[model samples]
Target: MPENLTAEQWRSFVASRRTTRDFLPTPVPQELIDQLLTDAMTAPSWSNTRPYLVAVASGQARDRISTELLNRWDSAAKALAGGLWGKIKIFITRYGLPQSDYKVNRKYPAELKPRSARVGAELYGLLGIARDDHEARRAQWGRNYEFFGAPVSLFIFTHRGLGEYSVSDAGLMMQNLMLSAHAHGLGTCAQGATALWAKPIRDEFNIPKDYNLLCGIALGYPSDDKVNTFKADRLPIEKIKLLPKNA
Candidate 1:
């Protein structure tokens, strides 16, 4: 904390950190990235057990993962377009079907669906993508595999020994990483899409069997693209806060 920094300034800094979808190809220095991870280590873990591992990809390695991921994304998109038969073919072939350690594409709960839908709608609207523009939508979605042009990709994994607690601890660590990146004038987008195909990651990293992929983050300098400016609406405290039993 800076001696001159106020509480309001800190709040504003946090609020300003948005999920950057478009990033410049400029590579982040390895030293700076190491420092950011050091900052992330400050996050408290469950019982001081930081049961998380991160696999970093940059340069040629990043490109290799992106290539494989893009192929899977395209295959999955084709299967999706083919309807029931498409789904069946992919399932039988196991080509486009998610080989993820965790199910990344499960149906959202009824209560949470609207919130998810709202954010999607808002982002597409900002991008001038029409609701009926399936082709455009698929193209936009495919960008996730490309890491939105980021120069670095971080595959986050959690230890299965602690189960959900490990996942929660990883989430906290990721938040710290994102905040640290923002403070250092970098940008990041945490993408569940990256976890849709674990084979690509597994092929690239010597991850232990006890660790499972949770998600990935695209990291680099944010481009001045319009997508970087999109800000989803947040629920107020009243909406999220719990009421007393009597009240």
Candidate 2:
């Protein structure tokens, strides 16, 4: 741990870290990325297995992946909007269907629904997008595949044999990476959407067969756009903590 950081400074750093949706096209330096990865590697893992792998893409590789991902997203979006015929087309072609190792569209549990809804509402509201505007929503969602114009994209994968523990370890490392990126004056957005289709990435990177893509992180300088300023509300600490059985 670095010295001279006061409690307040730590709190501010943690609290100020937000998911940046819009980023400048400026690329992050390779040295800075190396430093962040080094810091993130210090994150604790299950038995130090460190059962995760990361694929970092920039320049041409990043552009190619983004193009492929956008095509996939567009095909899916069109199919979903095309009604019965579109559904039939998707079923017949199997082109737009997600091949994610994990299901990304599962319904939220009843207890967490409100929290999810609130965050979604806040994000769309900031973007001046109405709830009924499906086209606008689809376009905004498509930006995720584009990495919101960020210059660096990181794809994280975990070992299948390790099961859920590998996922847990990956999550820990991801958090560390995001925090480290923020401290370095770089912005990040951890995107689950990027994991929806892995073929494009697999073609670009020589990932081991045992490792499965978990999610992606977009890294770059944040733009001053108003949408980048949106911050979702967090539940209070009291709500997050468990009460003593006797209390």
| Model 2 residue 153 CA deviation in Å | 0.4
**For candidate 1, lDDT tens digit of each residue in 61-173?**
99999999999888899999999999998898888778888888899999999999999999999999999999999999999999999999999999999999999999999
**Model 1 lDDT, residue 81, Cα:** 95
Predictions in order: lDDT: 0.94, 0.94
| TM-score of each model, in listed order | 0.97, 0.97
Candidate 1: segments with Cα more than 4 A from true spot: none
Q: Which ten residues in a row have the lowest lDDT in candidate 2?
A: 1-10
RMSD of 1: 1.1
Local accuracy of candidate 2 as per-residue lDDT tens digits, 72-189: 8999999999999998999899887999977877899999999999999989988899999999999999999999999999999999999999999999999999999999899999
